[model samples]
Target chain A: MRRIESCFQRLADQKRKALIPFVTAGDPVKEVTVPLMHAMVDAGADIIELGVPFSDPMADGPVIQLACERALAHNTSTRDILDMVKTFRETNADTPVVLMGYLNPVEVMGYEAFAKAAAQAGVDGVLLVDLPPEEALDVKPLMDAQGLDMIFLVAPTTSDARIKLIGQAGSGYLYYVSLKGVTGSATLNVDEVASRVETIRNLAQLPIGVGFGIKDAESAQAVSRVADGVVVGSALVNQIAENKDTPNAINDAVGGILSAMRNAMDQ
Target chain B: MSERPDFSAFPDARGHFGQFGGSFVSETLMGALDELTAMYARLKDDPQFRADFDYDLAHYVGRPSPLYLAERWSKQLGGAKIWLKREDLNHTGAHKVNNTIGQALLAKHMGKPRVIAETGAGQHGVATATVAARLGLTCQVYMGAEDVERQKLNVYRMKLLGAEVIPVTSGSRTLKDAMNEAMRDWVTNVDDTFYIIGTVAGPHPYPQLVRDFQCIIGREAREQSLKQAGQLPDALVACVGGGSNAIGLFHPFLNDEGVAMYGVEAAGDGIETGRHAAPLSAGRPGVLHGNRTYLMEDDNGQIIETHSVSAGLDYPGVGPEHSWLKDIGRVNYVAADDQEALSAFRELTQVEGIMPALESAHALAYARKLAPTMSPDQNIVVNLSGRGDKDILTVAAIDGIEF
Candidate 1:
């Protein structure tokens, strides 16, 4: 099984929802990322979705956009990100690592090469925010061949027909964007999300991970009730942004939020 | 490689223009774009929509703008006769209004009460604001903070026309950033908001619909060329930022085997300087702003900041159709540096008593170079996409003149 699948399977067996924390690959600094990933796992993250910083992250709000800018300011290349993933694999191989960002960076590094490099670097899944299943026809097979799951987003407005198509095309899980807006823009109403998640569940067989508007332990716990996983991005990135000046405080600050959310989710 | 594609059959139902121009937006936007595509497909041929669009174009936009022969300017160039397609004469003073008018009508039909747009120089903002005011729709325009500062008059114009001009301060703080912010807004408010994409870029139906709406320019230019010049012009020239005007003037002529086309991109210092926006001439294909197109990006595929004297032409990517046309060897993609465009701006102002927008000046610059090489009997139609009134401040600043 793919690392992402096995990670979910392990979580399911324990009757626990997955805690996925997303961080831009080289935010604040390059050296902070690998240790941060390890810290996130130690803090009770099931899967780490490391964002490959892009110049234009349209779907993201100000918090994560700034995170991308911080990462890109250091000239973090795709190779550097893959290297970070490889280094993380040295100490821990069990936690599934999913690279999340826009599509152009992977497009620059040819899809075949990106798939091979990502898989070899112990990365298990990719969630390109811009590349929907319609446009992923050519790239999906290449990723699947490399034992990499091509994860897709199911938005609040996504139709049942598209959910079926995405569920069949996707592997690992379907990330349900719990709001209509960009990440970190709005507050989530759990009931609305619950209804949407229920519809998605009826249409698609894959595990559903809910993100966007998940800001705190309460929100994460609320999402974990209906979701197989809770994907927290802007909130953790906001922690990194606030603690960026004190580099030493970043892992603890980010991990602290995830730990609290994990503890809350367990209850 | 085997055989050329039928130009008419392009952007197949999936919106791919020969591996370019696919709807590469997020899942949140896919359904919205699909809805838009389906709506455009239905209304593009509907006679009532067409009649309404035509009624507005004729009375409000001043349609069939004259294709004036620049006799004195052509005499000075000493080669091909130059015919100016007077898009600059349109209401709101640019070709951008053509697309805005069409989109506003669509907004009314779709029952969308709010309209939004991203503007580089604020021409599109002002145009959107103008239409929104006329239609009694709430309009919000996202413009880069730098642009809002630079284009103070246009910001004022939009506000006066009842638009909420929001300054986007993200990502290079320019046109691309404004577009990013606008996309975020659209995804958030997809139900009631109609996004009036200002150019021939963006996902699927936008490129198709914007092109369809603006095709009137080429259609009129074609008819005018025959009526005034006694035959179709030997060549067509238009500036390409996001390539709305160029595509507008070129789409109708795509099958004219006898006519050649040139799409001039803005070269800030020059393409070799790596600071320009001439993606077709220098950059490679990549995805940005929901479409696959040639983009000015670093080796890591991060979009690089572009520079151009013309704010409207400073975008890092060209329209995807232009990319397809470039690959198919249909439209000849060229570049004009800031210096050449400035000189052309001065020459047109002095010679023809016409002040072309700096964006249009890029096309004029190329025409100046090409006109001198051709025989006087042959003619060239240049799309004067907008007037230089908005750019007077930019010109004054360049000339070290203080207001």
Candidate 2:
């Protein structure tokens, strides 16, 4: 919680919007993850949302879905990704790494055991897309005990009442999916998101990060104007997909996109 | 949870059948599930809604489909009297229509203009399409590409009923993949869409509501068993895919201590071969789609590919209620290998002229094995959940006979 809070606080003091980029940990291969994290940090990412590959990423679009498929095709396990996080922490301990994915893999590992492993691996937080708030009571306390901020989604369909509950329950920052559809969906109604963010701000004191349709630098800058953080996922994942065959180029390709988004967010 | 459960009340307010079920879905879908759950709680008991549901079942979907005495087949084994709960006679040729008609009515009551569903053998697709056509609602059904090839007639049937059949090519290209696509559609078009999940699976209210809608099967069979036979049967047997038919037939019997219930899952080769859709038989409790249930997953929690000759019974995950029942010892979940189910499919058709879907044949196979072990005075009712007309093409191909 302190890592995320301090990162956002630092960004706020600098009068700069936080740039959050997401990548599947084992996408392309397991060897690229640590270097990619370092590359992303060098490219001006304030925090990293590391996606854990799940067989079924129900809410993600095709780009991220294929990313997960590629990762799984290489047979990436939760322990392998935790090892990646541990390796990343050897040189950098400041950047908050939020592990994101579905709940089944975590459930398979058992909640408390997975939380302990994650905390020991230098992991900072978790955002399970499919673990709705209604059922989150099962594992939230376990994650909390490990000092992992349990991030939750605040979508357009969520009521003011739900927003309040999610606000109280969530710790790191609330992810506001900018549209009703999945990540690669083209429709990003900035006006509607601004209005929803306004309402979300009123209901919660947490910093709001908007994603899922913020594809390019332009969309990132537009979203950054309205929210505390701008998150770009599918666009960067799509870039990785293009350069997957050349593993050596993946970090530069992914980091290049994040650099452009970070530049745009600052502008 | 270790003690015998209070079977009457399940899927508690947040949709939990003990630790097996809960609303495990995206935030975008939470409000929609909440809305549907509240609506179902209100309408499940409303007299007008029940009347509409009953009237449609009686006139439109063909209710009280017979508790048939398969005496011809029973005498061959000559150990016990075997009965078939004839859900295959229902309109659209399966027990799937019972839940579809009920959900269609619920969709109408909710004032939703569009409805969507996913199907494997296309029984649920055709049933959903049939109701949508009758009610003047736009409908779409997602089917795996492999199923679209094998169950061509049902695909045509669904399309003829005006449902746009979308062929899903992802994952294993089977029912599980189709469900994933359908869930994606429902999540995207949630505002005006009512997803008529064909089974007692998925997130909240779905597992509870679909079971409630189909429980008429067991309720009617319970009454008919008393009327046709002298008393309740010694055992209730049903095939389980996502476990709708099994749960429908099992839920009403849960509290009856005298009634022993068995859920038959498809063991494609054998349990030892590790190629089957028998989650309860071989899987561990894990989350999939939107519910935590027994799933065919690997040690690392990746859902494994499942195989069954029957497309409908090919799902890797069974329903949450079935998981709960299996855990509580209220239901015995066993598996029938492909060859056993195929042999039973042929035997029932030849002796009783009752062609069973391959999915239902799994139950028939188990019943055939169990029937010979009991006395003639005893009885067992196997849920013949669907017609085999959809499987004719696949059967002919297997027999080296071209249609």
Candidate 3:
């Protein structure tokens, strides 16, 4: 809890929105995963969210789904993702890493086992896209006991009563979806998101991370101006997918976006 | 030396024919799959569930549809006799209602108050919405926006049944996209909502549960065939679109070695044109929508868009169990192109006075071709999977004959 608090405190001190870059482990190639994490950190990514590949990812769009298919082709598993995190921690321990995915892989690995494995892998948080706060109560205690933050998504449709429940239960930061549809959808209601984030902030002090449709530097900047962190997922995954066959294209594309978003957020 | 063929068994423990059925999903969905499996196991023995399902099958959906002998068509073909299993007469104009009724009962028994489904051609959506309305459960259906336009009447029917139809405009904007959206809804509302999968696919219990529900088709056909002809038909035929209707008609005869099972898939153009949905005929095994099945994919393993005159048959993948059956050599999977199916669609309407759904016409086309080769003493039973009332406009548009 203190470590989590300090992570947020550092964000406050910086007075700049944290850049959370999400990448599916083993996307282009399985072997490049560790180096990719290091590259993102070097490129000024504040927090790294490693996506565990699942066969059916309902919340994702074609970009992430394609990335997941690429990862699965390489036989990426929960164990492989955890091992990648462990290797990531070996070089840089201060930077927080979160596992963002659906619940099936974690449930398959068993809750206690996943919690322990995640902690051992130096994972500070987890965000199960499909698990609502009410349904998460069963697993939240386990993750909380293991010192792993269980991040929850607060959409525009979320009621005030539900927002209070999610805010109280969620740890690390609250994920505010910028749209009603799945990831990579074009419609982004910035005003709605800002107000929803403000509404959620009124209920809790947890850092707010805005994502879903924050595709470009301008959108990231717009979101970061209000929220504590800006999550760039589908955009990065889309870049990786377009350049999957090219050599070192993923790193350059992702690095460029992160640099641009980081600069924009700093402004 | 090759071993002698034998076929006196049901789906093996893994829901397979030989190499066809097995649970192939990521570990997270195992619990839900297991829960469903356990529920199905208990429900199989529960007299109340069976009684309720039987009641609905009989009175509600108007089951025990006649097994009519098509004497005129069979005599014209000058070969084997042909028997029609009249699943088209089922309520909502298709055999889809059989599985829907069974699953709706299971949903109610499981204490789920809401039902969600995905549709491609809208037949399954209409059936699901119809049952949900009857049971007083809230229903939501995800359909591709393209499908919504092509199947506008069925979409309206679903809305009239008090169900919300969500148009999915993602990915290919077809059946696969609708499936992705539906899966998302299921994951979000797993606790209180029952996902009424429309076919014999998805993770474990769904394929098994749906097949069991639809097996009534094969079971009734077998009894009726025996009573009418005093012997099993030489060939059993049905169209394969995710393999539900085919599986329903084929499961009972799976044990009869002498009975040949033919599952016809849609070849939109010719297979050479690369615009077909013939999974078993030309596809590789890959994971999609929770199961490892035969799917049309590119070299990079990305699923490719498939085409058929019938929107229902325009899915890239076939049921995994069908893949197993093909592997074991128990079922001969064949393809019928759009022109062939269209001709059969016209033939059935003109000769038999029955207009078959374009999806089902593929099997009728194949059966018509096979009839000329068989002896007069032989008999073939074709599953009339659905009525063509929902597809008249589609069929007419394709033929440049506006209705």
Candidate 4:
């Protein structure tokens, strides 16, 4: 089993829900990303969803979009994010790191080359926000060949037919978008998410980590009741955005919010 | 490249047009695309769907748009006969309405209660809104904030047609951003929403479906050309912005061995300056907005910000079919700088008494250059994709005048 599957298995044995914190790899600055990744793990994050900044993040709202702009302004590429993962592996080898982004950068770099390089960089999983399983024929095999998990997002609108296909294709835990709007947009209905997560659980055996619209620790705690994992993105990225110029403060700021959510989920 | 490709076999069952187009969306959108694909496949041959589409084109969209020979402009050029396929005369003042009407009909048939689209110049937005209004469907059009500022009149036009125009303010604040926003909306509202993509880009079924709908331009132009010029034109030219208009005119002529095809891109300042949006002319192949196509990008694989005086032609990527056609040596992709397009826009207005859309002016500008080099017996048909009425304010600003 991959690190992601093992991580989920360990959590399931302990009867503990996993806490996943997402942050853009090069948001604010590149020099701060490795430190931030380490900090996220130290803050009791079971998984670190490192965002590889894309020029156009269609699934994201203004918070993550602006985070991408800040990262792009520094000309941060997927290679750089992979290098950051390599750096994180120097001190940490157990915490699974998932590189999340759109499909263009990996596509431009040739899927085989990216998968090979990612394996060399000690990457555990990849979640291409735009690449559905139907179109992942070229990239998925390469990632699987390297023993890397290919994660997928299941939205509230995803039908049961597609959920079965996603279950068959995807290897890592599925990320469930909790709402109908873009990430960072308001209004999370816990009841609706729990019901959909139930449906998804019945279809796919993989752990479901609910992302999007889970802003605060309270919301994360609520989502953790029905989800195997809770992913907090915009709220952490908002802290990173708030502490952009002061790179030293980002670790504490992102760590503080994620630590609160981790504690809240653990409770 | 030596052997000609079978155009009929394109976009194989997997939606690969020579490895250029595919469904690159997330799982959430993949199901929606599959449903859309099945619906489009079913209705493509349905008699009722065909009749409804034809009725809209003829009565609602004013089909058989005149194939007027620009005699005065041709004489001024003094080389070749220049024929204008006046798609600008359509009800919504652009060929964009052709695809919109067809998609709206599909939306109605699919029992979708709403339709959404992304637009840069607002021409597509207005056209989509117009169709939705006539069909009594709720419409929402995503446009870039910069475009909303530049194309204020078109923004108002779309709103008047009952669309909620949402201004996207991310990623250089242009058409690419608007498309991203629209895709987000579609993923969020997949149950009751049908996304009417305004270009020949995006995932599968969309490029094919849009082409099938807009193919009327080429069909009408072909019949008119045979009637007026007594032969197929030497060349067919149209501006390409995601290449809907150009592909619309060029798809029907792909099998005509004697007729050459040119797809023009907007060379904003000049391609030399590296500030233009002429991806096919100067870019490399990459994936963006769902398909692998020619794209302007930086060395790090990030999409480069593109510029163009015409909002419609300002995207960093072109259509996948155009990319396939370019690679196979079937279509010659070219570019027209902003100044050249403006000059053609002015010349066509003053000389031919028809003001063309800035997007169409690119084709006219290229035609002007090519027409001056050919014999009078030879002819070139330029797809006048839209009217300049929506672009009057932008054109007026260049002359130090304001509305």
Report clash pairs, candidate 3.
A104-B28, B7-B255, B19-B324, B20-B324
Task: Please identify which of the two predictions, 2 or 3, would achieve the higher TM-score against the true structure.
Answer: 2
- Per-candidate clashes come to 0, 0, 4, 0
- lDDT by residue (B1-403, candidate 3, tens digit) is 1553454343455444444445543222334555677888899778988989988999998989889898889998889999989999999999999999988988888899999999999999999999999999999999999999999999999999999999987667889889888876765466688889999987666887788889999999999988999999999999998989999999878878799999999999989899999988998776567665787866434567899998889998888878878876779999999999989989888988998898889999999999989998899999999999998888778669965
lDDT of 2 by residue, A2-116 (tens): 7999999989999998899999989988888899999999999988999998887778878888998999998999989999999999999899999999988888899999999
Question: Which lDDT tens digits does candidate 4 get at residues B333-359?
Answer: 999999999999999999989999999
Question: Model 3, B356: alpha-carbon shift in Å?
Answer: 0.9
Which consecutive 10 residues in model 3 chain A have the weakest lDDT in total? Answer: A129-138
lDDT of 1 by residue, B173-261 (tens): 99999999999999999999999999999999788889999999999999999999999999999999999999999999998878999
lDDT of each: 0.94, 0.91, 0.83, 0.90
Which regions of candidate 4 are displaced past 4 Å? none
Error of 1 at B230 (Å): 1.0
Best by lDDT: 1
Which CAPRI tier for candidate 4?
medium
Cα error, candidate 3, residue B99 (Å): 0.4
Interface RMSD of 2: 0.9
For model 4 the local lDDT of residue B338 reads: 98
- Clashing residue pairs in candidate 4 are none
